[model samples]
Target: MTLFTDIGALVASAIGGMQADGILPGGLDLGPVTVEPPRDAGHGDMATNAAMVLAKPAGKKPRDIAEALAPRLAADPRVASAEVAGPGFINLRLETSVWQEVPRAVIAAGTGYGRSTMGGGRKVNVEYVSANPTGPLHVGHTRGAVFGDALASLLDFAGWDVTREYYINDGGAQVDVLARSVYLRYLEAHGQEVEFADGTYPGEYLIAVGEALKAEVGDAYMGKPEAEWLEAVRSFATDAMMELIREDLKLLGVRMDHFFSEKSLYGTGRIESAIDTLKSKDLIYRGTLEPPKGKTPEDWEPREQTLFRSTAHGDDVDRPIMKSDGAWTYFAPDIAYHWDKVSRGYDALIDVFGADHGGYVKRMKAAVSALSDGRVPLDIKLCQLVKLYKDGEPFKMSKRAGTFVTLRDVVDEVGPDVTRFVMLTRKNDAPLDFDFGKVLEQSKENPVFYVQYAHARVHSVLRKARDAGLDVSDTALAGADVAQLDHEAELAVAKKLAEWPRLVEIAAKGHEPHRVAFFLYDLASDFHALWNRGNDQPELRFLQEDQPATSAAKIALARAVSVVISAGLGILGVAPVEEMR
Candidate 1:
């Protein structure tokens, strides 16, 4: 159902025939072949590199091979033409009937038309939005969350057994700060004046946790020693913060498959085991790191520490795993967590980190590489910042979050569908300006509404066709006189529809879900262009006055476009609108 491969396989078939006929060398492998849309559509519908890609290996001239292969490809009933262009690139023009059938395929397939089995059912662990569980998720975490969730969905569509995971920083000093902050709030609940110190969190979101603590243990620890209250308060505050964060994520339509606690990595000997494994490989060593390059930090001092030789696996320098005082560094738990992922037998590990954490990427990759013996590849995707704008003005932070804008603030103002779609309209690593007014705009400038409107229009056509007493259901539409869909405009939309399966494969392979958003925009443009042409060309219209045969054929093309838009929106976690409201 992925048209890209079907077309590529056809091209492969042609080259294969040439090989069999001795025009191409016998046993000349064509595995490196590729059939993709030409960078410039002026070249053709699709451009294949089979001849050129196979030339050097087969010891044959690329143009000679293309000339011999072109005829066999053109002979296929679905191919309208196959001409060798500059240097042996075979540009293929598919038959008009081939495009007319795409809509029927989409109507029959629903959102599953572009789904691929490219991953071969391999397990992939996508760990994202592991924001510290000390406070509510902010705008930065929102971008990371949407990017991760959409990427996971894209991989799932491409046949990865993907697990969307979150790592809780419940083991850090920050949680202790959460404990102290909540304790201060607890005293306030008991009517005692307390102050939020310099290092303590001052966010108002903890107010509810204070009230909850008062409800759970009213005045029980009002005058108790720090020892008697810290443990219980720490656990209570972490749970509350996690609950708040979960709600924030839910507002944006994000749900994690796993909420891994850093506390679990402690007291379990797992960290020791991971370090021991690295030590066994001589990757763990006790040494003094040289002062960082360019300028030394003020705290820089020469001292022996347990260092991980990460540079051996591609890091800039060896990293510290344990402090001189014998306490494990924050990186220790990370190593253990990835070792756990490796033990779970995942074929790949992908961590979606905020851009601020760009410094940690190499060490994390080294750890996973060592733990998995380089068998499991790790790809770390860093999501840049999202600057929220409202009416050409930068959005202000919530006083409640104290210097930050909360994710819920964004999601509450814009629906989850709009929030998710707009966030993904840009690449994950690229900084995105999310304008509240622009995203809500009804015109083509608003990609979310534009794509959704395309789907809604298709539904409108279906409603019209249904009342006309035509069998416009998928089964009936698939049997329409598809040959009537011969117009260049109609065929252009169908060609875009055919690219869906291939787009999914490429996007999933790169762990870039933004490609889906971009592809949807292009497909919608094609659909809209055709719809506009119908204003001047009545025969190109989706509906034919009292002519069911012609109507079904044209409607099939429109339905196919909608099917793709819906599928793309589904991958982005955006719900398609049945009608523009």
Candidate 2:
């Protein structure tokens, strides 16, 4: 279905035929051989490094192998010419019929044009946005949520059975602080004056939670001690906060398949079982870690503790899993969580964390490796910060969320489509500047607007063709004599469409969804270029007066571009607009 992949198979077959004729040695590795578009358009349509990769193995000169390979490739009906470039690379220019078939293939496949079976139905669990269930999600968590959600969708499109998961950090002491904070609000609901100390949360958002709690209990805990009501209040507060987090994620179109609670790992011997699995492999030991390099804390002391021999599996040093006082460290629960994921029979695991969690990467990787017996691969992606700007000044914090800008703030100001598209304009590891004024501007500098505008223009062309008594449906366009679309400008857009399948496989294999956004922008640029060129050359216009055949051919190419843009936007969780407002 992919033009580049088909051509690559043809090149491989030609080389295989060369081996059969005894022109070259047999059994040479062809894994390094690749067929892709030439970087310079003038060189040729496609280029391959077959000769360069096989020359050393066959004990022959690269140019000599290229010379023999060119003739065999040129013999194919689809290839127009095959020329040996510098060194050993062979550039191929396919027949016009080959490029013309691209639009027809796109029309047949519709939005499913780029979906691939590369994953072979393997299971992958992507865990992201595991922020503490203490408050509403902030901008930092928003980036992780968007990246993880898109990655899961991309993997699914590549034929992977992906599970989107979120780990709730509800077992930590922070939930206790939330309980105390809610207690203050609960007291305030009964006409009692209270002052929030430095340690308690003072956000006005929690006032509603307090009011709700008062409605439920009816002053049952008004005269109770902290010990009597702490557990119940903590449970209520975490549930409320998670509901808030879910609503915030709904605003940005992020949905998780599973929500695992850290508290569930406790009192269930899950942590003990996970550590036992590691102990059976001799990865668990009792040792004292050397003092860290930076500065020592006032309570820092070296003590023999239950440790994980993480260095055995590629970590920088051994990590402690249990404290000297018989309490599990923070790392224990994380190992247990990953062990739970490994037990579920996932072939791959991905963790999307904020940039500040860089230290957890190696240790977590080591734990998965030891637990999975080197079977399941783990990839951790760290999303950098998103800096907000408005009118050339830094955006202020949200008064509702107390300390940071909530995800709802961004999605509410600029609709969900804009928020999701703009978030992925940059790679996850790179810092992104979200300018309120610039993203809303209807210009080429704003990628979301430019891409949306290109899709809208395609619809305008369809409307104009319909009014002119031309059948512009996809079926009608697919059967048109597309050979009329031989202009370089028109063919350029088809060539870009042909890259969709290859691009999807590449992005899915790398576990990077930002590449989808980048590809869409380039495709939009090519489409816009073709549109602008039509303005100056009346013959290049999509609809011609009294020329239904020519107009249908041109309209087919325009519809193909829109189809690809829609598919790419779906991978990024963005909705393509038919009309830009």
Candidate 3:
């Protein structure tokens, strides 16, 4: 019910009918044309660029084609009239009943109103928030975590089979650092003095890991060499950090389907296998890359290394698969990880990365392309940083390994519902300023509160109507006298309801969940505006004395608004607050 199907289908069918009737040229593709809302609401309900797109191809004036197409489009029962406006745009107005039945359709569909089959049930793999297992997730990871989780929900709502995954960076030097840090804490737990080095993590989060090591084996590794305890501590610390991460995700309402490990890829020869695949295609060879564009490292020297011909697959330069010392480079495991995703038979792969990782996008895409032979499409989304603001002042927190503001810090500040919804207020690539004061404000600018308030108001009206001896339950509301919904303002709300389905498809196609947040704000605003109109015009109100029939129709419209709000909030991982506290 998000989009009125009949009107769009009729208009498209009319174009086909014109071709059959020979009024317009046959064999011309009319699909590139689109029907969308005009910039000015006064222009019309929907506008199409049909004539303008076909003007050059059809060799007819834009105005002439619009003039000829207008009458045929208007002949349909739903179309009240069609106007050829500026640049030969075809503006359309549907009949009153066409807009009026939108509410009834919404009640019939319930929460499924805006659900779309755009993804065709294809499998999509989304990987995000793959922060190192060295410590708890920070605020930067929070943005990506929320964005990825919501995007997966959005794709699922749009009919994609999605798998949410987190990649643990346990195989890197960072994990070794994590082990050393935990060892220092473990010694302190045993009443031994230890000094943290410049590279070591210093935070209270590792205290639990320190105690856990003590509990597992007392005085067994007190004086052991680094090698004797390094592996054990790395294994123990990684598990502890991952548990902390899982709890943080739980607080934010994000449930990952899989937690992949870089450690597993290391010992399983996955990196070697992926490199072999590249070698078979001659994409891998021993070579030396040029020094990084502007700055050269102090240790920079020309040495032969195993390189992946990423340039052949669209990267700016070739990427090394192995270092000069014949050890796998960091990019090697990443290539294998993506190769694993491609081998899983996913139709699409989406990776959410921090903005700093923009340079890795091309090489990652090239790897997926080379591995999948360009069959599987990979989309990389880079989420810009989220600046924290509290009490109208700059808010800064730790970003070091273990001392940072964990994901729990955020979810604890604002509840998960507010945390999730407020994070999506901006596009992923755009910077987000999360002001503590503004987000919780009871005003229109506070989208989280405004949208939630709209839902609460609907419930309030429902409660009032139920006590008035009217059956206001969803079943009763669905069977109400919807035909009585003839007022312009009432039907206007219904019109917004009809656009839900169409919006879902558009959002899913673009991999943008922020569009849902924007649409919800617009829908809530419309509902609120209509509610305000009732104060001046008594007949527009939801409750009418001695008129249960009209009351049912109006309440049905109001309830439909709440139903949409609930569904949208569910997608954003926010619980629809029945009562605004």
Candidate 4:
């Protein structure tokens, strides 16, 4: 259960008691009141700002409000003491038994202990790793894939109906370039030498696609004109590249619920329908935009074009939907894609874009806002670059990807678990340095290993307790005399366990799955600290020689730590280890 939320409710009830006793206004606003852990643990177990936030609204002094509310809170059986601190903040000391029960509750719930209902089953569409289907996925795309997948898992754990989606960029000039490149490979498969032109892909990864095309068509299109084979070849190359991308994602444990094709928006009346909806709202117009910032008017060319009044919805300027050549701009299909998502009635939409696309943020949000009439909210999370390091030096490019390191290369150097966990060890907006040399180390500096070691430690304790003739099953541990876990160090680990549900809600609300990685690191640190403390205090050890009940009680606490670690790692898409090798 959420201990902090329960305590916050008690604080609200105390405020009500004050109002009922005529010490404060009857209808004072208590919405801003909060109960949380004190900034300094030495102060108390928990703290509340109920007095200060209500002082001005209640027309009473801060200290006076706190004085009136303290006794009401202290009267609860769960609250051992409630004392007013500096400037009317109330610090609460909960009963020892309350903290002692946290581990037992964790054992009772197992890995599901931290699951939250904050989302209320609302639907969310998370679109990420929408790299163009022109080649294999690179390291940059790997970061986005891991971040988006972890976020979807975190939202799912927090009770949201999450759809993992990838928008395929298959409608633009890039796909045409891919078709020509694959044609060259097909010629090479036919024992004909070919040269890759300036605008064509030259990666060796397409050799198999070329050979497969040779097998399928048997050189029928070898001498055909561009119009006779462009469409079919484009379809073949796009499908093959997408197959490669799917395999790359599978290597990293990322699976999309849907693959939306940009090409489908064309020739299906969908693009026109979305633009027509905007036109009916009077948002479309033929206008010439002003010269861009830092550009002289002479350097800018103005033309009457189909534009969307994006400025009305918080964008910096209006955006053109169609070019002077009577063809759609790159933004036109993107707008239609998001429009399709909004029309599907998702409660919210989240796009995981690369940091280079930062300029498109406001305009895309404006499109969704205008299309949905502000009914759905769009959040765009941009992932910054990932710099890879190995052997104490920066890792260079991969020949397979031609210009950059591919996702498969990183996953092969270190397995998918290390690749995914290290990708999320930093904020999405912050640059992450992924060092192959450091991630696999057994030292505490590596968060992945640190968390896994903690989980393994608990399993180790369970095995030892079982060998000592103590019942260490979850049911047995959950039913043990948990009251024996009264030491300060033991209770500290339990207190950390109590924060799991709150941490889940916090991470889910911000759509930041990296926070889950950070929380697991902290939880592991606390568990490790307690494990070290058992060395000096023989009675503090999880296993006692003859006291089966006492050993079970302590093993319960250790097992609870493992349970939370597994749940946190599960959200991060990292499989928890049962034992360290």
Candidate 5:
């Protein structure tokens, strides 16, 4: 049902036919030939580089290939004409009937209109929003959470068996600090004042956890030393922080399928087992790394340690798995975590990390590669910072989060829908400026409002058609005379609808969901442009009060636009409002 893919298949068949007819050599690779929308709309509905890409390999001039391929493509009933453009590019102008079928198809399919089976049910593991359980999510984690969740949804729409996951860094020294901090709060909860010195969390959020601890165990080990209550309070505090994190995620509508804990690898021998697997591949060795560049050689000393040969798998340097003191470094558990994911039989793995973790990307990839032996591909996406603004100035931090704005603060300011939509307006690696005042503004400058307004307009048209005693149901709209939608304004909206399936596949393959947001904005712009034209031209209006047949056809087009916008918003994990208040 993907028109672009169907046309691509037809083009491939024509190439094979030419080869069978002795016009071109058999078994030539046709993978590079692409049938896509032309860069210039004046070119045609679709353009192909088949002739230009195949000419050199097929031992013929590009113009000759184009001249021969043009008639072959035109033979299809859908192609009204196929013309050779400059430099052997062939542009195909499809029949108007072909474009008209798009809305009917959309009405028939509903929200499933743009869904594609491009992934073929491949299992994909998406690990995102894996901030340490030390505190509630911040603005940095907010961006990663939105990006990773949207990306997973986009892949799911493209037919992948997607697994959404979160990795909890509950085993690190940070948790120890958290335990001590909670202990201080626990002491304070027992009617004793405690000081939060350096290396301890000072956020007021821990106050409730501390009180809960006091309730759970009253006067038990209240005067004990660090060794007596450290482990118990650490476990208790990590659980509390994770609960807070989950609530923060829920506020933004992010739900993870699984939460893997780094602590799980500690006593389970998983870390040792993963390191042993790499050792078998000769990827592990005892080596002394040279001092980091730009550091004084006299101030730095190299010591032997267990290291992973990460350079063999594209890392710039070998990474240490164990420290000089024979303790496992932070990288050891990470390797085990990825190894566990690899052993789960996922076809692909993706990690969404904050941009500050940029240095860890290559080493993590190397570990996964070594463990999986190149059987699975790992993609690491780093989300850059988000700058929050209000009234053209940056918003202040939350006192509860100590130094940064909490995810809850952002969500509470603007509801979840606005927060999610605004978060995805920019690419993951690009810094995003989220203006609280600007996002809520019901202007075209705000894409969330613009897209939502277009959807609401479609519903308004459908309502008008229904009030005029015309059937605007999907079943009736599917049978409407969309062929009568021949006006340039009507066809322009249909053409935009036609790009949905193609856009889904493109976004899924590139692992970028921001493309869906961009496509929705363009589609919304086209719909609004058409709607504005109706003010001057009565024929372009969707609601023809006196003519039921004409109104049904026009309503079918409007309903199709909503169907696409809803589907795109669904992929972005944003709700499509039926009406704007």
Candidate 6:
């Protein structure tokens, strides 16, 4: 159990006693009440805002409630002192024994230490990296992939039944461009020179696809008309591109539970069914949208079209779902796809989109709301761009991707663990400057290296203790007499360890896996601080010669830090290194 939550329960129990004794009114809402660490360490170990939140409702002064509650809380053996601080907050200093139990609890739980049941096993589908079936995934798509995968793992750790999904955008005109590009490569394989036009892809990656097509059908469509070979080439090209995308994802340690094809929704009545579901609710209609607010486009023209009344569900205005030519608009398939997700019985839906798709957020949310009838919640996270640098200069572009840096380029330079960890060092919506030179440095400035170094140091401590004939296994450490870990520096690390469960629940609830990375960094900082302090104080060291019991106690604390670091790294899809090279 989490120490914060356990202390919160104790605070609630004390308030309940106050209500029983008629010191305060009954039936007060304690939802806003929280027990967390005090802002100032000298104030107390933990602080609660129960009195401040209850003052208005109970019609009693905050100090009156806090003064009455303090005695009841101080009565518990676990509480060393329960002092009323400031106006109403009750600051509690728990017994040192309470903090010592953190290491023991961590040792007992192992990698599962911070896992929670906060989700209650609700279903959530996280769709990310739905880049078009173009060549390889670029750095922009890489950020979305890492964010979405980490979010899914975070939700799973918080006890949600999560499905990791990728929406293949193969139904658009881009795939047709891809097909034409591959046809050029196919023609080149037949020894006929072909020049790539403005609209077709000219990336070097398409060369292999062209040769493969030539291998499959020798010169069959060599001089055929566009219509005669367009469909065949499109199918073949998209499959090949999707295979390339899958390989890129696999290299980054990302695996999708499902890949929903946009092409599958077309001609399968899925789009019609989804629109019909909305039409039944009067969300579909015939209309013409007003000119957009900014400078009117040169092609701007008012034309009657099939529109979705997205404003009814909080969109800025109605959106077109079908063109006058009876062809489905780009929005139609997206609406249908989200409707498909809603129809799958998910309690929640999350889309991880690149920053360029920021404009689609409100409309997509409106579509899901109208389709799900507001039963399911939808959250769309936008991942900003990643700018690569090497030696403090802008990194070069990938020759294979032609226009941008590919995911493979980054992962190949720095391993997947480094790529994933460094990608999450910033918030999803913030621009990240990935410096190839800095991330590999073995210094505190590099978060990935610093955090991994802490873990490695713990193993070093364990190894030294083992060589000294000390039993430092997790089983032995769990039963260690941790009362010897009474130093303030040692207990400081234990306090940080106690924050793990609460931090996990908070990060999962907020759909911010970056918070996990930040927390791990802070935890590593605390661990490193203790390790550095040990250098000056012999008794503060983890492996105390001629004192096996004290060494076990200190090593148990070190092992707990490693456990938490490993668990946090796992959530970020990073492998913890035992020794840094």
Best by TM-score: 5
Model 1, residue 529: what's the lDDT? 92
List per-prediction Cα lDDT, in the order shown.
Answer: 0.88, 0.92, 0.87, 0.92, 0.92, 0.93
**What is the Å distance of residue 275 in model 5 from its true position?**
0.6
Best by lDDT: 6
Instruction: Extract clashing residue pairs from model 3.
Output: 2-498, 2-499, 2-500, 2-501, 3-498
For candidate 6, give the lDDT of residue 177: 92
lDDT tens digits, residues 50-124, model 2? 999999999999999999999999999999999999998999999988998899899889999999999999999
Separate clash counts for every candidate: 0, 0, 5, 0, 0, 0
Candidate 3 structure quality by residue, lDDT tens digits, 1-581:
54445566766787788778876787777777888777887888888888898888888899988998899898888789899997799999888877777777788888887888888999999999999987788888999999999999999999999999999989999999999999998999999989999699898788888989999988788999999999988999999999999988988889999999988898787888988999899899878888876756765777777789999999999988877677888999999999999989999999999999999999999999999999999999999988888867887655434556667777777778888898899999999998877877899989999899999999999889889888988788888878889887887788788888887778888999998999999999999998899899999999999999999989999999998888888888888977877
Better lDDT candidate (4, 5): 4
lDDT of 4: 0.92
- The residue-by-residue lDDT of candidate 1 on 105-203, one tens digit each, is 888888799899999899999999999988999889998999999999999999989999999999988898999999888888888888888699888
Higher-lDDT candidate of 3 and 5: 5
In terms of TM-score, how similar is model 2 to the real structure? 0.97
**How accurate locally is residue 386 in candidate 6, as Cα lDDT from 0 to 100?**
95
Give lDDT tens digits, candidate 6, residues 1-581.
59999989998998898889998888999899998888899999999999999999999999999999999999999999999988989999999999998999999999999999999999999999999998999999999999999999999999999999999999999988998999999999989889988788888899999999999999899889999999999999999999999999999999999999999999999999999999999989888889888747675888888999999999898999988889999999999999999999999999999898889999999999998889999999999999999879998855567777899999989989999999999999999999999999989999999999999999999888888888898999999999999989889999999999999998998999999999999999999999899888888998888988988999999999999999999999999989978
TM-score of 3: 0.96
Weakest 10 consecutive residues of candidate 5 by summed lDDT:
394-403
Runs of candidate 4 with Cα error greater than 4 angstroms are 26-29
Residue 428, candidate 1: alpha-carbon lDDT: 89
